[model samples]
Target chain A: MIDAKHLTKTYGTKTAVDDLTFTVRPGQVTGFLGPNGAGKSTTMRMILGLDAPTSGTVTVAGQPYRDHPRPLQVVGALLEARAIHTSRTAYHHLLALATTHGIGAERVRQVLEQVGLTEVASKRAGGFSLGMGQRLGIATALLADPETLILDEPVNGLDPEGIRWIRDLLKGFAAEGRTVLVSSHLMSEMAVTAEHVLVLGRGRLLADLPMSELLAQAASDVVLVRTPGADELGKALAGIGATVSRTDVDALEVTGPSAGRIGDLARDLGISIHGLVPKQVSLEEAFMDMTRDDVEFHASAGSAA
Target chain B: MSALETQAGATVPAPRAAPAGPAGPARLAVRSHPVSTRRVLLSEWVKFRSLRSTAWTLLAAVVLMIGIGWLAGWGSNDSWAELSPQEQATFSPVDITLAGYYLAQLAVSVLGVLLVTGEYATGMVRATFAAVPRRLPVLWAKAALFAGVTFTLMLLAALLSFVGGQQLLGEHSATLGEAGSVRGIVGVACYLTVVGVLAVALGFLIRSTAGGVATMCGLLLVLPTLGLLLPSSWQEHVLPYLPSNAGAAFFSAAPSADSLSATAGAAVLGGWLLVTGVAAAVTLTRRDV
Candidate 1:
């Protein structure tokens, strides 16, 4: 289990992670979600004790990570940046880290096989593709079979099969009663893999809840209506206190009303609704809505749209 | 394309094998040992030996030490007849046979800097520190391992250079039993080993390959040359204390008039190592990786 209280990190007046307090329990995957520069990496570094917190404390398995007699057995982390020396072969890289904890070459070979890097194990990391590099990083994290596994952007450069493989791997770890905390900007991946999520924006906790609850919160009542008489329906819906916005020449997006209610009202008003579909907000959309105001780099207004 | 297929084929254990259940083969029952100085030293040894640069740089140091020593011996022998009585009187065969360390030290210094800076350049220090979180063990281990390796390899190089250079020197050769000859050969290795340790400390303190190399070279090579611009009185007080000059006094068979004694030179170089080592430890433990 990982517990952090009042964690904050600042660099010369620019705060990266601010006042974050949360507990990551075992037996489930906790997704750490944030946009770029939102301190997900910084918080992970602090948890690993690679970076000292400006204030507060973060501990893994009941004590600070550095205090663990065998830190690799307690927590294994794959940092966002590639941490393997490019000049060294994948096998040697894993061997060097494993040797620190007296982990044997057999365990190193096991992790290599687990990550599907057994074939390229003897090759220098500099020659590996992006997907291969991610696999090596995962292999390094899994070397000691720790109780808690922390991975930053684990699937950033993975292929579809690799992504699916990592998802299963994380789920398996969780199923085995190990704590898994993965950070990523990819909400779709998290939606499938994470049972719980801690969302961060501008270095503050925006939401710390179960994935089901978050998805439920993101579910909107807005319905999309298609009709030849969209203008008439929009006017009628607006008059009845529903938010109506024209999306196409013949369609209207109506909020604050159920699809069935919109259909019945359209029928009553002779609007001749041909299509009425309720919009379901995806985790991606929910995340965007939650962090829209907190995005650090805003592409000039309409450019992104 | 064929290689890609083989890679994909190997990875497809069961295309869509049910995610490894809690009791799957994915789990390995491996035992973990606590981090200790010995294990960290072993880890560092592996890291040191795994890199190609280590082998190449050490090879360069070895070859330069022996090869240049031979050349210096041959050159001095060829010029012996042209030497005046005063010049002949001042000539020390021990100094000529061990002179290759002048160039060999550069190779050793570069390797020392690369040992630490290479990790920073590749982001590997994060993994290293994460594995051994108390962190200082890693610095200490690298220094200890590097010093051991440098001393062993450079000592061998020094011995070969002395024997080979003496052979080339013919009648002018100095035997190991000659005064200061044994100290010259052993002291060259000791001096290079200390310089290597100092480079490792500088590597940690600077944490950049270029910056560490420049600073190390500047202290050893440039700083001494720059000192000549000082007044002659100031030069006597300061130049002998610079890292290279102080180190030279330890290994130089014919001690210069302005240089410190052998024991004092070792102390001064030891002082340099202590100061840089402490600063490196402070930065390493206190700063973020």
Candidate 2:
């Protein structure tokens, strides 16, 4: 378990993480979601004690990470993909890290095989592709079989198989009762992998709840009605306390009302409906809405669309 | 104590048995073991040999030291034969074995600078400090490793160079018991190792590979050059205090015309090492990696 209380890190006049308070529980994959510069990386760094908090405390399990006995065993982290010397082979890098904890070389080989890096274990890590580097990073994170694993952008450059492999791996780790806090900007991946989300925008917590709650809190139960009298149907739906928006010249999205209700309203108004169907907001759309104000760099088209 | 919070839609696997103890969150004990200096030393040694750079540099220092001395002694036979009485009186056969100290110090200094500076360059300092957060232990371990390696290699290099250079000297070899001769040759090895570590401490304080290497070389080579151009009063006051200047005393039995006493030079070198080590520790512990 990781608990960050009022975690604030400021660099000069820019606040990277602003009074961020959240708890990452064990036996789950908690996704740390944010757009660029939303303090996701900074938060992870502070959790690992790589960066000192300006005026707050973050602890892994109970005590600070640096204070933990056998830190690698307690909280293994892969903050950077290549947080290793390029000259060292993957085998030696894992060996050196394992040596600190008195973890034997067998564990190193096991992790290498787990990550499908056994064949290339003797090769220099500098020659690894971005996907291979991610695997190595995961290998390092799993070196001590750490209880609390913190991986930042673990799937940034992976292929489809690599992505699936990581998803399954994190799931397996969390299933083993390990606390897994993974930070990534890939919402699609997060949708499929994250059990909970700690959403951030402009360095402040926008939402911290179950993914279900976030998706549910978003405008839901959307009904699409296509009719010759779309404007009339929208007016009729609005009068019935449903929020309506024009999606197209002949189509209107009606929320807070089921398709049955919208169809009933259209039938009562004697408007022949070509289509009436319920629409569920995609996780991508719900994520966008949740982080609308929090996104650091809001591209005009993405926001406007 | 462990809470498993799962997002909607994303299927979370059930919690498996904890690796060691309970099924829920496992809190770390508040108590911590006292930091062991020996463990830190062992860790530093592991880090030192794990890198190819360290191995190659150590090899270069020994090989270059012995190789250069052998060549200088062997190649200078004609010059030694033709020397006038004045030159002959000043030229000691043992002195020829110390010729490689100049080149060996450069290799050792480069190696020393890289030892500390490489951490900063590769951003491994974060991982290092995370593993050993007290900070001082890390620096201390590294210092011990650098000093130990350089000293051992220098001692070996001195022995090899002396043997090789003596072979070139043929019948002109100086005996090991000769006054000041034996001390000078062994002193060169020990002295160069000390300077190498002094360079490492400087590297730690600077934390930039190029800057550390440049500053070390500048102190050893550049400042002495500029000092030579200075007036007698300034040169005498400043030159003896520089690390290389003070360190040069270890290479000689006869004192320079206006050099510091050997004891004073040793003290000066120790002072530089202390200052650099302290300053590096302060910055390392205080700064966020």
**Model 1: lDDT of residue A146:** 85
Give the poorly placed runs of model 2, Cα more than 4 Å off. Answer: A219-222, A234-247, A255-258, A300-305, B1-36, B81-88, B170-173
lDDT of 1 by residue, B1-289 (tens): 1123333233323123224666666654788899999999999988998999899999999999999999999998988999999889999999998888988999999999999999999999999999999989999999999999999999999999999999999898899899988899899999999999999999999999999999988998899999999999899989999988898888898888899988899999999999999999999999999
lDDT of each: 0.89, 0.78
Model 2 lDDT per residue over A18-124, tens place? 99999999988999998878899899889888788998999999999878767887777878776776777778877766665666678888778777677677776
lDDT of 2: 0.78
For the predicted complex of model 2, DockQ is 0.22
The two-chain DockQ for each candidate, comma-separated, is: 0.57, 0.22
Candidate 1 wrong stretches, greater than 4 Å:
A301-305, B1-19, B23-26
lDDT of 1 at B128: 97
User: Can you give the TM-score per candidate against the true fold?
Assistant: 0.96, 0.88
